[model samples]
Target chain A: MALVELVPNFSEGRRQDVIDKILAAMKEASTAKIIDSRADPDHNRLVVTIVGEPEETFKAGFAGIKTAAELIDMDEHQGEHPRVGATDVVPFVPVTGITIEECTELAKRLAKKVSDELGIPTYLYEAAATRPDRENLANIRKGQYEGLKEAIKTDPDRKPDFGPSELPKAGATVIGAREFLIAYNIYLNTDDVEIAKTIGRNIRHKNGGFAYCKSMGFATKPYVQVSMNLTNYKETPMAMVVETVRNEARRYGVAITETEVYGMIPVDALLDAAEYYLQLNGKWNRSQIIEKKLTEME
Target chain B: MALVELVPNFSEGRRQDVIDKILAAMKEASTAKIIDSRADPDHNRLVVTIVGEPEETFKAGFAGIKTAAELIDMDEHQGEHPRVGATDVVPFVPVTGITIEECTELAKRLAKKVSDELGIPTYLYEAAATRPDRENLANIRKGQYEGLKEAIKTDPDRKPDFGPSELPKAGATVIGAREFLIAYNIYLNTDDVEIAKTIGRNIRHKNGGFAYCKSMGFATKPYVQVSMNLTNYKETPMAMVVETVRNEARRYGVAITETEVYGMIPVDALLDAAEYYLQLNGKWNRSQIIEKKLTEME
Candidate 1:
């Protein structure tokens, strides 16, 4: 069976009650399984990870979004992370036996369902975007919640892809279909933030690096990090990004202390690296892996 | 959940009715999923692969063996592959969240169940063997079906690990637990079988090669092959084996044209090679892989 992964980011992360309600709604779609869910109080974001059949995932995502919209009031929400609605962003990632185009179709169907049923304004980003500007989440959410609400009234370009022109009290929702984004962070041995920044600049696309890489520098306690969002792992692999960062960091006399996978990552990224390193000739199929065989048994 | 894979070899392979009965028995377990099942008329053997929760796998294996015993008579069975019973050899392999020792325990338990219920004599080989002599399946089944039954009367060393003193008309069964053996074959561009044998000898453990590698040379239609059974991939990785074969084959002016994973291989084996090739520093966790995330969702 084909598997689709849904990562729904809700606005309220501080309140356990709000998070529980949204999770319960997702669980109502029994066919879908909750892989991981985290409520970061600092970010004030409740990110719920789920995977299942495409239909079940769609039902679960809609149920979770509906619950979040009812419980979270955007006017009262406050967090370090940017948001435009109660259900801030919902992304459908094609996991197995599915294509990106198919996921885009599902995203559109779900967006239409949310607009018609919940009266929530929705803007499709990434692969599901109707407009070129809407192709990026950063572009779609250029203005924060309050700013977006005002821009919708004043700016013709600010109108959402779905729902009314005016944003509701709960605010607008951003939904899309995108490849799995691996939030990878490579920590440097040195505490010098400048080194991290330099490495990030050298490897990130914005600074003339890999096409599918987006990067930034951040400091956390004893270490400085080159935080990266692998936009398309197939186009530019996680290993390549890490190696580039390593090479750039070496020029600054800094070594990689460790790396962190912030969230979920796809298996293909690892398989691609394996094929390259092993120099395994011909076509390599994942089904030959014993773990894959075991999963199929399940 | 812990996964245990059962790959059972049966004496009969030419008859579809016999293969169907064996597969049906495996399906009867419900939880055990048949990953791969093939009947080789040339080899005159049926190899069935199934994986599931340890308990479910045990149940399915027992069911399949019982069905094979009922349908196959060793006295009338003939196979090119070495065998001594209807259910020739059953090897329990640990895949995920399980240890080889745990699989060995499962193999012992399953062996007892078969002997006690079906009155089939069973010999434990590999990790589950009580004696060093019975550690190898080839050593245990040296005499094959016709010879082993006669040898059991006089040869004190040929005694069965379980069941009655003599082998039944269906023959004795070999059951054990072992580390997952990845049967990898690298086909060379040149059809010189001697070059393949020389390379195989240079990389195989028996001839001062990799510690966990066992290799032989064989010819298959269009190419000469360096057929290998990686006993412990963790110790000597698949990539290392491939590289060693490649380097050795170059002495005879032969290039490794392609490689084939004969059956099932653990994802770790491939991932290790990827890490080496990619030079990916820090958090290179299998859990970060996308396919693994999907499986966990399941």
Candidate 2:
């Protein structure tokens, strides 16, 4: 069976009871394994990472979005992070034996179902975008919940790919497909946040650094950190990024204390790092990894 | 399912039909994946790698050994490698969620079945060895087929562990349990075979080097190679070995060209290498690896 990773963002984060209900509903609805569940009180959002076959993953996302729409009122929603609906954004990532093209199709179907049944408008972003303008998530979420409320009815440019121009209290949800993202963070020796910021700006794609990289520096107490999101690890590997950061840190006379893989990372990403560090070549066959061979047999 | 890896070595490798028959009988008898099957005509031996749960893997090994005993006459077998039986040695390695102690139990059961049903004397080696002297396979296979035939009837120390002290056409089989062995090789920039040999000796356990490592140097045409078998990678990781070899090559002013992973390897071995090379700390969770998470759910 093909494996797909679905990350669904919901508006309710602070309320443990509400979050539990939504998670439980989704778990009961599908056979997918919810590998990660992070509820940030500041962002006022809950991000759930689920892995399973395409059909079950789609079901889990739908169930989660449906539960969130019922519990959360977008009209009263407030958060540190920008969002558009009760179930703000759901991105489907290709995990094993699945392609981006296939994930895009799955995203389109989820968008249609949400719009049809929940009456919550959906905007397709990234690989599933109909127009080039909507490919970037920020472009689709330009106005947030308040601005999009009026813009959806008046502005043709703000019209979603699915559902009516008007939205319910739940608001519009951004649905799409993207490559596996590696959340990597490099900690600096000193507590100077500005130094970390300078290094992050130099190594991130937004600042004309590595492509498919989004990074920002944070004062994470004991050490200043350059937190990064590698949107496409296959094209822009973790090793190249870490080495570049190492070089950048050396310029400021500040050494990196350590690096952190913030969440569930694909095994290939780390294997890439090992290959680069060990200077291993063609003789090493990735298929020879026992677990991978067992997966093939399965 | 508790996964076990079984590597069975047979006496006949020159005859394709004989090797195919032995392999076919094993596959037909059990539902195990025959991942690697290599027949070396020079050694006149066939080594087959099978992966499956305990019971099925036991069935597969037994079937292959039984077929090999029927087809291969040990008295007529001659090769570069040492051997005492048509089915020389069968080693059961714990792959996933299984301990060496548990694998020792499995190996003993298989040895009993082989000795009882086939009447071919068996001696347990490695982790399953009854005596400390038999812990090393080289000690058990000291005299090969010719010497073992007479020693079995004469010497008390040469008595079989499982069956009668009488010799059969198949001779004796060494059955045992051992940790997953990683077949690793590193090639150097220069074709000087002695440089590779020195490096190999400096890093191998047999020559007073690293623990759980067996290594040698070979003149592998384009470049001299340092070949190794890492018996217990959990204790002595791949990163430590690779880095040591890299440092050793530096002394001789020779650079490492590349390294080869000769056969199937456990995922944990590479992950340990990645963690070391990447300088990744606590934030990374091995359980978070998507494929591993899927396997855990299963």
**TM-score leader:** 1
Residue lDDT tens for model 2, B142-197: 88999999999999998988998987999999999999988889899999999999
Tens-digit lDDT string for candidate 1 (A114-179): 988999989998999999989978887877998998898789898877888888877888888998
The whole-model lDDT of each prediction reads 0.84, 0.90
**Lowest lDDT 10-residue stretch of candidate 1 chain B:** B277-286
Show the lowest summed lDDT stretch of 10 residues, model 1 chain A.
A275-284
**Over the stretch B1-298, how does candidate 1's per-residue lDDT look in tens digits?**
5777889988888999989988998888658788888899988999988888899889888988899999998888876888999999999988777888998899999889899999998999999999999998899999798888889878989988888768887788899998888888888888778888888888888899999899989977588988889988878888778877878887778887778887677777787777665545555666766556655555
Docking category for candidate 2? medium
The residue-level lDDT of candidate 1 at B267 comes to: 74
Residue A2 of model 1 has an lDDT of 78
Q: Which residue segments of model 1 deviate by more than 4 Å?
A: A40-44, A186-199, A216-227, A242-260, A291-298, B187-198, B216-226, B243-258, B276-285, B288-298
The RMSD of every model to the true structure, in order and in angstroms, is: 3.6, 3.8
TM-score of 1: 0.87
Per-candidate interface DockQ score: 0.53, 0.64
